[model samples]
Target: MAGILPKLIVFMAIFITLLTVIVDGESHSFSKTLPLRSKKLKREKMSHLHFYFHDIVSGRNPTAIKVAEAESTKTSPTEFGKMVIIDDPLTEKPEATSKLVGRAQGIYAMASQSELGLLMTLNYCFMEGKYNGSTLSILGRNTVMSEVREMPVVGGSGLVRFSRGYAHAKTQWFNHTTKDGVVEYNVYVIHY
Candidate 1:
């Protein structure tokens, strides 16, 4: 009888603890939901996409051209803009030159003195392929010496409306003499 009494008491104590926790949780939820029920719902549809961008920007060979602006030399830092074209690597040949894809135009404002990065605002226009007539733009700073730079995508137009996300760019090949390099981009796009 003594052992049974102790077991019954212990079981009652555990049951009481569980009941208290459940009651407290229900009361708290009721109190919190009253204010939330009056609030308006803001929901958005988000879609994710990934693609690769290969660019060969050059100043000498003229893949990327400098505008007729003031003191826009490559060696010394200057506020300048350039127009660049990117062709699809898969169809890159003399006869398949019409299979162009990207046209990136942007300006390079000297962002910092410490690392030599540019305050870049680039409009990447897709001229050919499945994403033709769409434009994805990005605004961020990229250091000249950085092997990889991740930048935020601002917005987009055409099929990619209301786009926002991030992109990673790596300088694959660079020429110090001609001020040109091949940049590989892995872009992540989130849009509605």
Candidate 2:
């Protein structure tokens, strides 16, 4: 009877702690703590964002090598070559044409050494139009191969919270002389 009583008490405690909640989009109140993935919340839908990044890498921009030599540290990240903050234009450049569009403001830094290729990280924001104020992050290897690179969208902000998806990047043009280039991205996201 003692063991049975303890089990019954535990069951009742759990039952009492359970709650019913109603979220009205704008505001929400939580009576009980629940996992963020609770099905009681609204169902998640997939979202997509596709845009082109026109990185016209001007010579005026400081290279990572210059930064490393300038900083001259005895320890860590001794070789920095390609860390850059992006302020590129996002275009809806189809196969046939390219159009003026929004802007992409973000940072890309070298996270690891290049054994096969350079592994970089992205924390980028989209400004203007439907995706205004949305930010996406990624950790990907940068290689100028003909094959498209797939980048995982780790997380996001604004309308892209709880974001998880993949972005396909294709280099359109890379100028060896001027050090300018155009890269196109097709991003797919699922967020709540």
Candidate 3:
């Protein structure tokens, strides 16, 4: 009976180990033992998308709105602490009446006290052609007065899955009094 008890304990331990492995197999499929290629995300490619972003803060139908600001924001040199939420239009051309391609929807804030630097977190959601319903996320810094500002394309969804790249933004035209701007965006991205 003593020998039988020891054998039964060993059997229980082996059974539990096998059960755990089977239950957790899907969650740990890409563990150290498995190679990344096993998942089969192959034939990566790069794409460049050019568009114009219109940020209108003046008119009654503004696209970008100042949603929040600190008490000292109005007096600050760079308006640091002012945050704006935007649903700006993305067009094929710099003109506001150009063909619409997508929308830049997100928030940006003045994050630098010494310079007019903004922390941008937005998504370029495409609505035309093969990119319809796809989105590319941008999260980086933008120095407003600079000749060219490069922002990172962190990730994406739909057609641009597992994407990473950068976007070059050049202010084509800006109205000082109205605080409206038209920015040209050239995005280069790598995706599978």
Candidate 4:
């Protein structure tokens, strides 16, 4: 009788909880708090990474290419409406021949008709030691002509899971003739 009483109490509690959830129209919620997958990073940690991004659009083997564009994009002063898909290499140094650390794979669109503003959506996938297989996602506005542009680090995967931060990009070199450039990136991220 005592064992049956305990089981009945538990069953009644569960039923009441379910009834309340349905009555409040919260039964559709498919969300619940769960423990972290890995407890190795119990405390939040900050990471600073420096790298050079090579955007090669004009080379025979281009890393970035215009995948789509509006009819008026070619005539537009800012090349507005043009969309570029990039698999640009992230190198240790400004030179393209330098050691490869990862690749910036994503797309950017000319979101501004008046200015050279781009809507960047990319993932910085690291291949170097310690950060191998980790990726940090960036989604923000980038005014390329600015001396230094800041963008948000929205989220990430692998070692960078639950990461959020910002990145500073400064154009190190740009060639008008080739439409190629090297942008230095200093990224700071916080993760747990």
Candidate 5:
């Protein structure tokens, strides 16, 4: 009877531990958790599109006049470099406007590193502002490395979040020619 009681107690302890693990695992949450693969398609369909630009060589300027003009005027461009037009709407308030402009500049800086064939680095800038009459919170910035291949594509998605919204920017650069080593770049952004 004593031996049977000890074995039963061990079994009960293992069962309780397993139950505790299952409950705790289901409750963990991060502020910026990524969507599961099954949910990605649905989320992408509802997301607004934004454009990202990269300059892949030093001293070379953007060939597109429209892109240059938009940068000089501090207006966001729908299409630039290898990017295409998309329907991401900006928040109409002055505070939100400024924040987006600042973010654009930061993107430019990060892209410049890709020009030198280096991986870009993005840091968390918890700047304060307002968006849609609500307090704006800068979650964090994610830096994705560019790759050189036959058809260049951004390796991973870079993400930035606000209090009520978030943005994903992806970028890549490929060496198109060995002679003079011309590099081609493409960037994509999606907002939700």
Candidate 6:
């Protein structure tokens, strides 16, 4: 009976150690191995998408602008134009478009154009309720444009800098030309 008890203890210890190793191995593998692949994929996708958006924005397309504007208006109608909402305690009217532009310019001076573009893309994703991990395939009709703006937080103490802007479709049937050669459109701007 004494010998049998000792053997049982040894077996149990070995079993527990093996179990722990297996569990920890899986956890380590997932965190260390999978993230590398995931991050690489994300970077690759973002690079491809950046080029695509840049092309579309630089391209002279009127239809794309109309579609983007329509989509932005449909998604965020209340926040569409500059307006004073004195009655609403939750919202504060922005100071001015020029002020927002000034803030953006300051931030833009510090960052590279690619970084700014990435920031704008991220803002659009947040406003659109799209996951950042998801791929953005820009077709002729589904193009995006971004504008940078600085706005004071509605209730917070400090000002929040953001790329608040909109995107438009470049190949829609109803297209309008802005004073500049660029297509005129509205993009869902991010507050943060």
Top-scoring candidate (lDDT): 3
Per-model TM-score on C-alpha atoms: 0.56, 0.61, 0.82, 0.84, 0.28, 0.19
**Clashing residue pairs for model 2:** none
Candidate 4 vs 6: which has more lDDT: 4
Q: Compared with the true structure, what per-residue lDDT tens digits does model 3 show for residues 1-192?
A: 999999999999999989988887654656555565886777889999999999999978999999999999989999999999999999999999999999999999999999999999999999999999999999999999999999999999988988999999999999999999999999999998
Which lDDT tens digits does candidate 2 get at residues 1-192?
989999999998776555322232222453555686674446777987777777765666422221222233223342334456666667777332466455655555444443224455666576667667878777676654546988788888777777899888888887778667778888888888
Please say which candidate is ahead in TM-score: 3 or 6: 3
**What is candidate 6's lDDT per residue for 89-176, written digit by digit as tens?**
0001121111111111010011122222111211211111233222221112111233322222111101112222334423112223
Off by over 4 Å in 5: 19-24, 27-100, 104-115, 123-191
Clashing pairs in 5: none
Q: Deviation in angstroms for 167 in model 6?
A: 12
Clashes (backbone N, CA, C under 3 Å), per candidate, total 0, 0, 0, 0, 0, 10
**Model 5 lDDT per residue over 1-192, tens place:** 989999999999999988986876654455334555544433432223232333223234432112222343333232122221111123212221222311222222222222322122222222234212222222232333334322212222223221123444433233445211222222222322
TM-score-wise, the better of 2 and 3 is 3
- Candidate 1 lDDT over residue span 73-122, tens digit each: 34444333333333323122222243445666665555564556767687
TM-score of candidate 1 against the unseen true structure: 0.56
| Candidates arranged by lDDT, highest first | 3, 4, 2, 1, 5, 6
Cα lDDT, all candidates: 0.61, 0.64, 0.96, 0.94, 0.31, 0.25
Off by over 4 Å in 2: 1-32, 35-41, 59-81, 94-101, 109-116
For all the candidates, what are their Cα RMSDs to the real structure? 13.4, 7.8, 4.7, 6.0, 14.3, 17.7
Model 5 worst lDDT window (10 residues)? 83-92
- For the record, the alpha-carbon RMSD of candidate 4 to the native fold, in angstroms, is 6.0
lDDT of 1 at 99: 43
Task: After superposing candidate 3 on the true structure, give the runs of residues whose Cα lies further than 4 Å from its correct spot.
Answer: 1-40
